[model samples]
Target: MKKDKNRYTVFEHEALYVHRGEQKLSDAQLKAFQLFYKERDFPYYSLVHNGIRFCEYVGVIKVGNLTIEVLPKADKSNGEEHWRSILIDMMRSTGLFHPDSPSYSSLKVKNSTILDMYLELFATEVERLMHQGLIKKYRKTQSNSTALKGKLLIGKQVTLNAVHQEHFYIEHTVYDKEHLLHQILSKALTTVVKIGTASHLISRYKRVLLDFPEQRDIKVNESLFDKIKYDRKSQSYQTAVDIAKIILLNFHPDLSQGSSHVLALMFDMNALWEKFVLRSLQRNAPDGLEVSGQVSKDFWTPETGYTKKIRPDIVIRKNNEAVAVLDTKWKNIGDANPSDDDLRQLYAYSRYHNNVPSYLVYPGNENKSLSGMYSRAFVGDAQTPGGVIKLKVHSGKRDGMELLNQNISAILF
Candidate 1:
C-alpha cells in the first residue's frame, strides 16, 4: 500500500471515524486499539460511536497496516501539515525525540513521519556510538577455562573438572561491550526494524544493527533503563539510550490481535506545553532572574499521611523572592472569560507564593496579555493583598518559540 493510502492524520481531540470495510480502521484494528487503551491505562484516546477520539496526547499510533498520526492543535482551522511541523519543532524545543543535525535535514526534506524521525534519530545515535567505539564493561563469566586467568571455584572444579584435568572450572571477570546499555540499544534497533514503515529507516536500522556488537538479548522493562548509570565512559550513549527507552518501552506486540503491533509514541500535550514554555523562559531569562518549573509548596499536612504539595507550572524568582508564577494551558480560550477553576487555582498559587503575580498562559490567535486583580484576597477579609492574575497568550505560529521568548522577556524584564 502507498504511504498516503494507509496513513490517517488527525488533530488532538478530533475523531477519526472507523469504517467497517473501507479505508479506515478494520474491526481487528479497532479491537487492537481498544485492547491497547485497556492495557496501557493511558487516556490517549476515548472510544466514541464508530470512532476513536484522540485526547490531549499526540503522536503516531500504528495499528496493523494503518498509521494514525495525531498532531497537536491549538488553532482548529490549521491543517495537518502545519501542525506536524509545529509539533516537530515543539518536540525539538523540549529536548524530546528529535533527530541530530545531519539526519534532521534529510528527514525534513523527505517529509518523514514521527516514527521515521525517531527511528532515524536512533540509527544516527547508534552510528555515532559505533564510530566512537562501543564502551566496554566488566562482566562476570562462569565457564571452564584452559588458562587460569581468574578465581577457580574449588567445589565446581572438583565436581565438573574431575574428569578433565586440562580444563579448570572458574568464575572470571572479562571486560566486554556486552552490557545492559548495549543490550537495550540493540533491542531497540531490532524493534525499530520491526515496526518501522519507512524503507530508509529500516535499512539504516539494519545497517547499524549489523555493526553493533553482539549483546546478550535480555527482556527489556522500565526497571532495566533505571539501572543504567552513565559515567565518563558511557556518557555519549545517553541520547541513544533515551531514544531506545522511548522505543522499547512503548512498542507493544498484541498476540491476541494476531500480527498487529501497537506502537504509540504519544506525549501529554499539557505537560509538553508547560515544558516548552519553561524551557523557553529558562533559555531567555534575563540576569538576576531565575525561571524554574514544577516548584512545589507544602499546601497541607496530614497527621498520619504524606503532606500534600502544590506545584506551580513555572515560577520566576528574583534574588530568591517569588516575583511571578505562570500556569500554562495548552487549550485555546478565545475572547472568553477564563474558567473559574483555573482562576481559583491561580489565586491559590498566588496566595501561597507571598501574593506574587500569577498568570494563566494560553495559546491564542494573537499575543494578548491582560492584568486583573482580585477585589478581595479572601471572602472574610475586607482588605485585598493586591495580588494580580494576568492572562498571557502566545501566538502559536511557526515562530512560537520566538513569540514565547518575547513573552518571557516582557514578564521578566
Candidate 2:
C-alpha cells in the first residue's frame, strides 16, 4: 500500500501520542483531526496538543480525503487479522449483513484489506443489481399542460387557472427506471472516484454509474432513503438497496451541517456489540423466553399523562413477564470492575421490571466469573417480589456468543 506522508493512522479504542520521533502534529493537522475526533463522540480528543490521544470504533474514517482506519489493536501474538475474523463473526451473529457479502470462500486466502473487502462486495452487488435492471414505477405527475394527459382536473380550480390560461390541468403517468437506489449508487461511485485507491475497480464502478443519462444523476439526501419501502414486488432489490444504504450511511462528502470538505465514516462498537448480544440471545434463549430489545415500561403514570419510561437494552420475557434484563457493555472488564453507575442502572432495571434478574455483560479474560448484588434502598417495599442485579465478566477471548450462552444459562436454565 502506498503511504501518504500527511496521513496519520490510529487503532480502534486505542490511545497514543500523535507524534513522530520528537515532532508532534502541526497546528493545522491537530485542528483537522480534532474536528473528526469530536464528531465521533470520542472522549477527550478535544484536547488538541502533544500527546493528545484519540480512539474510536472500527471503520475507515476520513478527515477531508485522507483515510484513518481504526483497526482493533492487537498484540504481536494475535495481530489485527485475527481480530478482524472475530469482528466478522460478531457481524454474522447479528444476522444483519449477509454472511458471504464479499462472496469470497475464505478470509485467509483473500489477503484483502477491510476497505478492499467492502469495495469488492459493493462492486459485486452493484453488478448484480445492474444486471437485474433498475426498478420501474409508474409515478403520476400533475401539471398544467397544453393538452390533456392521463386525466384532466375537472374542478373549479381548472376553470380558475387552466381554462383562463388555455391549458389543461393534467396528471400523466411516466415510467422508465429512475429511483433513489440508483441515485445513491451514483453518488457513492462519485466518492470512489475521489478517494478510492483501487484504480481498476474505481474505473469499473464509474462506468456503471455513468451509463445512466444526465437525468438519473439524481442527487439524493438522507431523507429520501427514509421514505422508501420495499414490498414483495421490489424484494429483488433488497441486496443492492442494503449495499447502497451502508455506503451512503458511511460516506458524507458535503453534509449540510458540516464543512463541505469534511469526511468521517465510523461504526460504534458499543452499538454493534449490544446488537450482537441481543441477536445471540434471541436465537438461543430457552423455550419459554422471548428476547426483545429497547423494552420499555412506564415508570410513572400521573393523573394527566405518563412519564419516564425505563427502556433497557435486552429484556427476556417469559409468560408475558420480564424474567431478565441484559445490558451489554463493549468495555473490557478485566482491569475495571462494574462501575457504581452500571450497578445503579441495573438496580433501577430490577425495580422497573419487577425485581427480575438483571445482567451487565462485558468483555473479559479467560478466567471469568458472575457476581450478584442486591439493593434495598432502590426498591422500597420489601414485600414486593422482584429485584436482583447480576453481573458477568464474560470472556471475549474466544467465541463471544458461546461465552454469552454459558453465562446466561446459569440464570435461566
Candidate 3:
C-alpha cells in the first residue's frame, strides 16, 4: 500500500520519516515542516522510530509543501456533550470571539474531524463579520461601458482594441471593491472545505460563497487592508477587518510555494494556554488588581544604550505596579517536576522586576509545590532576589464553568 505523494499523516506526538517515507518530501517541504514548529519555540518533529512525531497540538496546517495527517490526542473528551469544548474554551479565552458572539456558542469538538472545528470557528467568525456588512472602497475600474461613465480607456483607442466596439464604449467607473471581498471569502471557504470532510460545512460554506458568486478568486499575498479606509461611517467593519486579517494571513488556496500558500488554522497550544489563563484571570480579577500580558519592565541599558527587555507572560499589577507574575505552560506534569528552562525563565522575570511573586503555571498537577532562589551568586541573590513557584491550573482539560472557575480561582489565589 502507498500513500499519496502530497499527503503526509501522523498521529499526535507520533513520528514519520518525511525524507525517506512512502510520501517522500523535498528539502523545501521539510524545511517548511520544521520552520512552523520551530517558530512556536517547540520542536516541530522528533526523530523517533525513524518517523516525524508532532507535539500535542492537533489540527490541519498546510505546509503547502505537505499536508499534515494529524490524528486526535489520546485523551478523549470523556464523552462530553460538546467534546470540542476545549477548542471553544481556548478560543474564547483569546478575546477574539465575544461571549455574545453569534454562531459560536454551540460549536463542539467531536470525536472525529477535529480539524473541522477550526474551520467552523474560522467560518463562524467570517459569517459573523459578513453579517456586520462588508467594507466597501472605491476601486478604479476599466471596461467598455454601455453608457459613458467616467474617463475612457483613451490609450486603447489608437490601439483599436475596444474603440471599434461602439455598443460597449470604453470608460472607467469608480465602484466598490465588493468583488475583492468576494474573492477573499470564496478562497477561504474553498480552503476550509478542502481541509477536511464535513457534510454540514459544505452547505454553510456554499451559502457564504454564494453571497459572492460574481466575485473572483483571490491570489496569495493579495490583501486590501491597506487599501480600505477606516472611518466612523465604516466603523461597522472593524470586526470584519480583524476577521479578514486572520483569514487572509492563515487561509491558502493551494499547496504551492510552501507554507506561505497553505492555510494554517492551527494555533500553538503554548500561546493559547497562556492567553486563556491570563484572560480568565483578568476577567475574574479582584477589584483592586489588574491583569496584563507581555508587560514591559523598568530597565536602563548602560553600554548598548538600549533598555534591557524582559516580558513576563502575565503580570498582575496592583494600582499600576506589578505585584505578581505568572508564566503559563501547556505541559502536563503528572509526576515529573517542572523543567529547568521553565524555572529559569520565571526566575529571571521575577528578579528583573524587583523580586515579584513569580509563578510557573502548568496545566497538570504534580501534587507538589516547589520553589527555588536564583541570583547573581548563581545560587542566591540579595539585592534583586527572586524565586519560582510551580502551580497547576488545567483550564483546557475539561469543560463546564465549574472547572474553569476553580482553575482561575486556584491560579490567582
Top model number, lDDT:
1
Q: Is candidate 1 or 3 superior in lDDT? A: 1
Mind sharing the TM-score for model 1?
A: 0.88
The lDDT for every candidate, in the order shown, is: 0.77, 0.60, 0.59
List TM-score per model, in order: 0.88, 0.74, 0.69
Judged by lDDT relative to the true structure, which candidate is superior, 1 or 2? 1
Off by over 4 Å in 1: 1-3, 20-23, 98-110, 377-399
lDDT at residue 179 of model 3 (Cα atoms):
53
- Put down candidate 3 lDDT per residue, 1-413, tens digits, no spaces: 13446655555575656468565656666565555445544444553433446776655556653566554332333322232455545565576555554554666643323345545765676676667666566666667556766776666654654545663436664656455545555666766555443455778877776774456565546446555555785554444345556656765433434334555545566777778777778778878898899887755567756777778899988988888888877665555666788778877787776677777876543223455455556434563434333333333445543466555666456
- A best-first ranking of the candidates according to their TM-score comes to 1, 2, 3
User: Please, what are the lDDT tens digits per residue for candidate 1 over residues 1-413?
Assistant: 13487788878887766674334777777777777778877578998777678899998888766788888877767666667777777787788854454445555522556776787777877887888788889999999989887889999999998989999888889898988888999888887677656565677778788888887889988888888888988888888888889888888887774577878888999998899888988988888889999988899999999999999998999999988888888888887768898888987887888777778888766666666776663633533232222323333444656766776677546
The best candidate by TM-score is: 1
Per-structure clash totals for the candidates: 0, 2, 8
- Comparing 1 with 2 on TM-score, the higher-scoring candidate is 1
